[model samples]
Target: MTRAKRRWLPALLIPLALVLAVLTGSVQAGATVSLPPKTADEVLAMIARTQVRAFSGTLQQTAELGLPDIPSSTPGVTPGAGTALEFLAGSHTARVFVGDPTKARLQIMDAMAERDLIVNGKDAWFYNSADNSATHLQAPKPGAPTETLPSKPAMPTPEALANRFLAAVDAGTEVTVGEASSVAGRSAYRLSLAPKDPGTLVASVSIDVDSETGFPLGVHVQAKNQADPAYSLAFTDLSLTAPDPGLFQFTPPAGSTVTTKVLPARLTPVPDADSSPKAPSPHGTRVSGEGWGSIVMLPAAAVPAGLTSNPQISQVLQSVSGGRALTSSLVSVLILDDGRVLAGLVPLERLQSAAAAQ
Candidate 1:
């Protein structure tokens, strides 16, 4: 893909991915259980101290984000956009296997076709059965970081999603422990995070932490004023034992077209307390504000020119004063006439103001 084409992928997927990470199946509520109580701080500490490195589980995701359904067969719709819409509106099921820090696999089961993402040591592959295509990426070293593949929409595991929310815990958020519950047949404590800022579209987020292993088995995100969760991902079945080593192996079937790429030795690293903040990109992409109300700004040069003209995208965006907007229960995206794109959990007015200020 060309640079312009690659740039559109993240801009289009990020908003949806932020809300859709983690696959799901049928909705299943665990039975109520009685367990020893722990303070919010203790539960957070437990999650931080978790030692789990390998497991296999069946994950189910459900979203009631109130997004309009866009069929995959729609004319002028790209496969990527179609898949993103499919994930944004309904329930999905996937089997996940993790052997270690460097080995993992996710099988997204569709009715007629299946999508697979496998990461083994420094090698990663994405396969889409619907089109009989595969993309292979090899890193320079065994521990090199892998970039997100554009071929398929990959969702995170519950443990991965839990870590993301936990990292944002601050004075702007209220943390508490809810009632004890059972998830995947294991006793767990419910850790709740409520944003103090009422301006955020998110109302609260709850995570179920395993009592014995301290691993997260589920994550539920509730949107403000919504009766159901805007997004929920949980394991319907779980096992701590490592999966079969053979599961991580992948080979493109006969007649499948395979694309190969070699990744660099190092990728961008997450900044830590001791590290200096990185400078903004040449494209002028930066985040403004803080906490739950923060907004992401991408200058005109960063946004793909054809986004607004795409039929599938145009169907969901409504015209506003200065641009087109896509709004969901948890996120809002604004595409200005000037070609800039602004998105966040904040309201549309917030994005408009940010655009005007620029």
Candidate 2:
């Protein structure tokens, strides 16, 4: 949830969050709990206050996507998971963000018999192997508007839903029983949930609770996409502890193409525009990208409009180390180093102070 890029994938595939949910529930068989179904409102209440000090795990996302007649101007509409990351979490410690691209990190799919997309924070100078580009513009202020998953879906924020999911389970949302099944090689209980609202991106999810621990041993999100098929996620290798602190940091190698952060032609000189956040670019290009694994957003919107993209994004990145995003609605870009810009849509001053954590 704390990841700046945290978001839901399309219906064809399950959003990345399911991996987090399975890890939170059902620890070991020895640590099982009784279940009494709960409701949406009730579930929300419990998640709000749960203390999550640290987390780490392997995540799996598979989806069958539905594409529109026209290309989507939004995220999650894609038929495939846009990108996936392996993480090691901590409250105050750093977590390595692995970029396992089926295309970039996922590149292994081309070589290995059983494709393995694996990138480690400790061994990821590979980010610079690709052509990196960004636009230089004044950082925007905070209070920008981001359209929800569906253009009209009224889903709650991760912050809002985190506590709710737990609360709903504690309160017992109506749960129905299903036949036994083997998921990821374990006997588990299958629960079918009839959502009160079909409009939910997730109409039904099959939660595989470990028969031994009473906890979720494996979870699956089966999305319904007519436009694109093959969107669903099955997450294996779950853990509830923090990963190595080194996973979150990055250092671009020498001889990389550090392009300039350019501003869009549409947004250069607005006199009365409200605070706008530039869409931050990725550390890697679209053909391939590298995930920071763990993300901590510093509000740049609060800073003075003087904060523009690194005048020479290439020079800044080469001078420094690590990678980040510099984006806007018109041109969302990712910077590979801290000196690189992380795009937002707010005005520079407003976005600079978007958060106090920075």
Against the true structure, what is each candidate's TM-score?
Answer: 0.82, 0.33
- The clash count for each model shown is 5, 101
Q: Write the per-residue lDDT of candidate 1 for residues 250-285, one digit (tens) a residue.
A: 989999888876643221322232332323444456
Model 1 misplacement above 4 A: 1-28, 72-82, 138-155, 261-283, 301-312
Poorly placed runs, candidate 2 (over 4 Å): 1-53, 66-174, 177-191, 196-203, 208-219, 223-230, 259-358
Q: After superposition, how far is residue 184 of candidate 2 from its true place, in Å?
A: 5.9
- Screening candidate 1 with a backbone cut-off below 3 angstroms (N, C-alpha, C), the clashing residue pairs are 24-60, 24-61, 24-92, 25-60, 25-61
Report the Cα lDDT for residue 262, model 2: 21
